[model samples]
Target chain A: MSMIGDIARLPAGVPETAARPQVSVATAEDYVALLKPRVMSLVVFTALVGLMAAPGPIHPVLAFTALLCIAVGAGASGALNMWYDADIDALMTRTAGRPIPRRRIAPGEALGFGITLAGFAVVVLGLLVSWLAAALLAFTILFYVVVYTMWLKRSTPQNIVIGGAAGALPPVIGWAAVTGSITLEPLLLFLIIFVWTPPHFWALALIRTEDYARAGVPMLPVVAGAAATRRQIMIYSLLLIPVGASPWLFGYAGLVYGLTALVAGALMLAFAWRVWTRTEGKAATTAARQMFIYSILYLFGLFAVLLVESIAGRVVG
Target chain B: MDNKPDPTELTEEQKRSRRSRSIAIAMVLGVLVVLFYFVTLVKGPAVLNRPL
Candidate 1:
């Protein structure tokens, strides 16, 4: 988990004063920033929920270790993403100041760091948890880094739609950690996150249109325009509500989770609707940012309710 | 990323900046190492069975 500044300290193989000029070598910390720790945190949370909800039992130590491995694998994917996107990130205002483009880390260093972490995570999971979870973790890393980062990003505006499966796999991996295989319950968790990703990510993309355009990144807003992207967000938001509520109806969660999902879904729809009506201005940006932030809250809140319900079930049952 | 550092640029400024940043990174890494062992090595196993 080296920070962006750490990578920026790389002593060699950084080209500065060449293309755009005004660049310096990447330092150590920038390398770590490449991993996107915040995103990793959410991934870990969902994975933990999956592990906790699964039917069978796992040793608490192995559970903790499995969760850690999943988190590390996620970081590895993010680091690789930074390594590959360094060139484009420099051009986007939102990402221009990132480690690589800012001359804080070399691309090679990031590649090495990401690959090393990916390997370490897989090995740890294999030893401490089932090989299945380890294998899924490895697939997530590879899918994000290669399938999404290298190919889908450059290929289509539909990248997020297809590549989102990687992000969604965490819950399944967690479930498999305990159950040692995938099942309907874990798939439900995966579906909830999978359907939520487009709306959540697209909201940010609405605000980041200029950034994506500048960087030549084919994000939804850049490829589909703001109006179209907003419509898509609303569509996806509506889709998420039912999917989020599925666990409760199927007997996996109790009333606490059901109510939380309902309230969160309604609020998310409201925000998405507001964004849909907003025009191209600061107001639109505000709506988009609000939705992005609320979406995170909504997700975490929904999962928290489920966790509470499960613990309550254990006590009552 | 720029492919080459300007050869004409003097090493003095670059060297100074490098020294400071490297020291900072090393310090952070050191802190992380200590925290990892202290929290995990010393406290990890105990906390696993220690339930809510």
Candidate 2:
């Protein structure tokens, strides 16, 4: 609160009315935007798959509690990200309309909202699930906001590579929330997302090259050029194929999931190949966009297959 | 500051909007509190067994 009060005194349109700044009433939709609901949905789904796939079954309420905690924690990270990136967010055409950049929510309000949600989620998870899960959730939020967004994003082109760990932690947290410990199974899931992040993100970064460059964010495409980025995307895609298949190879999943992984992996590689092979303007951008869109489906399909297989296994046996 | 509107001088419309926003935020907070109670109930052992 004091920090927000201090920000109010600055000339950054903090509203000179020190007693009560005239802020527009933020709508429910604005709050939802702050939560980055799209990203939160993915987090919830992946975490749910993790929870369901774990060895033991949990009470329904506790399971829902854990999922809710992870969702809130992910949202908190998004809010903090918006808070810090408000400056650059205003610069980039892609992000110029985000809540903070558009002045729909004040930076201080965002920070407070993020911190409060994060604290509440962590505490509730610890009390309801296990301290270990809560700790991982807390670390995920901190790493995403402080380490990735604040430090590496602006400093290094390898930002997503290192920062991908935060995104990868959800399943592990979910696994821990259920089992109260980490295991090889959840670690394999973690590796899949970890290896998948670069190609998935770089494909989009390829098209948003100008936006990143204008924002002064050192995305791989902006820093290393389009050709190099394309090559790296292919490399990561190749690596992803095997890792994506690991859950199947390890016997953790059945025929349905195995086939899904194989097909998804092939399509991912083929698209990345297209991205690499195409050298022209619109064609190359189109390829990258195709890869980007397919990458989302690939991940979702892979996880969906896993969830379905797990449910079938539970019912059959 | 001149930019700060006095709460007492607020028009009826402004006051109504403020009241609605306040209620919405309060409702969200209340729901969260209810959720906490449910969590505590579900994991009573964990919540109760933790050493203060």
Candidate 3:
């Protein structure tokens, strides 16, 4: 297939997932979407960093199982979020086509599925790994579904900022899975995800302001206007520079990761500035879109640098 | 006020009361189903402890 076709076929993302829920029709892919596989990807990647960076060794089979539990937990959160948000989702154009909203799957069934996965994930992680990890996983699901979805979402513009905390916990949970303790390094990883979430979300909010407004969801863009949203994006982008560098500053990673972070963060802020200056249209949306994509790469590169540096040290010895 | 009741009248008040009770029962049952799914299916006791 042509590259453009590939891009065109890509899912419109979480917002759209709720729009045509009934269109999903109980396929394997439908179940997969319930897992929010795309979100699970980044969760897995970051949690792997925590697993790898832990002080001691983990048995290989057990390590695989622990990672699996984390992935399952993350998936459970996605399903629950979908189930809970289906009501407002039907009103938003971006979300109107999702499985529940579309009548492809029943809302009660989605809730059952999510609740089942949530319990399964936590119990397995707790049994196979540590209770600390399990507890964190449980909290992550609760925070996402209840604290964020049911409570904070329509109540305030600061929803994403507070809700972002749940997303940031995975890596720490992964680390504690191995060590059964929390530490500064995992906290650094948590900080990175936390700082990264706002700009990441707001970029999409900029693109979908009208949708959020229609749903009465109170996203930053819908509440604050494009100009204010751009200002916030740029503000977060600038702050990300120092936050992204924490791993290197604290000595968890090497010079390569530090240098890469410095360059990537500068580019991110520069893009955010461009976004801030643009008159809203294709140009503004494109810049916001680019920042959104780059954020993912920025995270992947940071963690990749950590793995590469550690491996190189071992090989050199 | 004084009122005389027919032996078997279907009053609006009685009908409305029945409908509200039905809705309340359904809501309770729905909540229970969701809670049960979490406790029994999702977090079953077998998975809570170490493998034998």
Candidate 4:
């Protein structure tokens, strides 16, 4: 018999045949996708701002190393997150195309990859930069992977609220990389991102309520309904204005940063107000989407202003 | 006698992917070496004086 005919005639449900080992076809790009490059970029940018805002001077080489370690640490957390949440990711429309969900990379492979990178990033940062910074980076990874991803994410509607701590730590880590100590300035930066995360993420959750519901993840919109989520978004947005502007109030930032914060923050409030009032049909969804998009811009604008002012001060002095 | 292909053998696509992953790992290793070298240069003799 021909090979094709023999295979076709073989027992359809044979356990032995089904147990055949398959070689991995996962490429480098699939591995990179596991790292969640978009999230890493935001981490790198925020860490850079923190490093630049620090009081002391850092060698350019050391600064680069610090940023690199923070970026890798963030990526490692993202990979581990994908590994653990692969089941939920496969169910959600937004994440269904991820490497693990698509079966391009095995969950075990992602776990190993995340662990290796996490160790390498932490060890290198400790050896090359301040161990304080390294410690913070290590804590950030643990919080994101263990505390947030494993504990908070599946359990409560306030998952991202408390989990934002991990995301807010990069700037603090960056500051520690420079000074080997934490201060009010980096804490203020932490405060801004922490407050920003809820309104930002809830806007996305508002649009993907069904996705979260299907995945059995208790996102705010899934647990509290759209009306409550919008109200919460408005509340957080209101809270963010004062928190976002506090750096200038404390005299850590210059006039440019203060003005930018007030105007941009007002716009953020306006967007949240729209999300609050337009609570029906396509208008509500559009308002949420617009707020989501603007939130990214609002954060980038605030940080870019601070970074530029810091650079300008350095040059002038 | 059956002339069936070996299930253990990699397909062409799998071979390509494996090669790409190997190259990427090699490049990362190379970059780490250069990074450590520069770090040492920047720190001078103070590199060994790591504080807890």
**What are the per-residue Cα lDDT tens digits for candidate 3 across A1-317?**
02222333546563432332122225444566678888998898888888877777666555666777788788888888888899888998877877778766677778887888789888867766678888899999899889999899989999999999998998899789888999999999899889989998998888888889888899988887888888998899999999999899999888898998899899889888888887567998888888788888888888888767755654564
For the predicted complex of model 3, DockQ is: 0.02
* Candidate closer to the true structure by TM-score (higher is better), 2 or 4: 4
Q: What are the runs in model 4 whose C-alpha is more than 4 Å off?
A: A1-21, B1-7
TM-score of every prediction relative to native: 0.80, 0.89, 0.78, 0.94
- lDDT for residue A226 in candidate 4, whole number 0-100: 93
Q: Go through the candidates in order and give each one's C-alpha lDDT.
A: 0.81, 0.88, 0.79, 0.93
Among incorrect, acceptable, medium and high, the docking class of model 3 is incorrect
Task: Give the per-residue lDDT of model 4 (tens digit) for A200-266.
Answer: 9999999999999999999999998998999999999999998989999999999889999999999
Cα deviation at A59, candidate 2, in Å, is 0.8
Best by lDDT: 4
lDDT comparison, 1 vs 3, better candidate: 1
Candidate fnat values, all: 0.07, 0.20, 0.02, 0.70
Sort order, TM-score high to low: 4, 2, 1, 3
Which 10-residue span in candidate 3 chain A carries the lowest summed lDDT? A16-25
Ten contiguous residues minimizing lDDT sum, candidate 1 chain A: A17-26
Query: Which candidate, 1 or 2, would have the higher lDDT against the true structure?
Result: 2
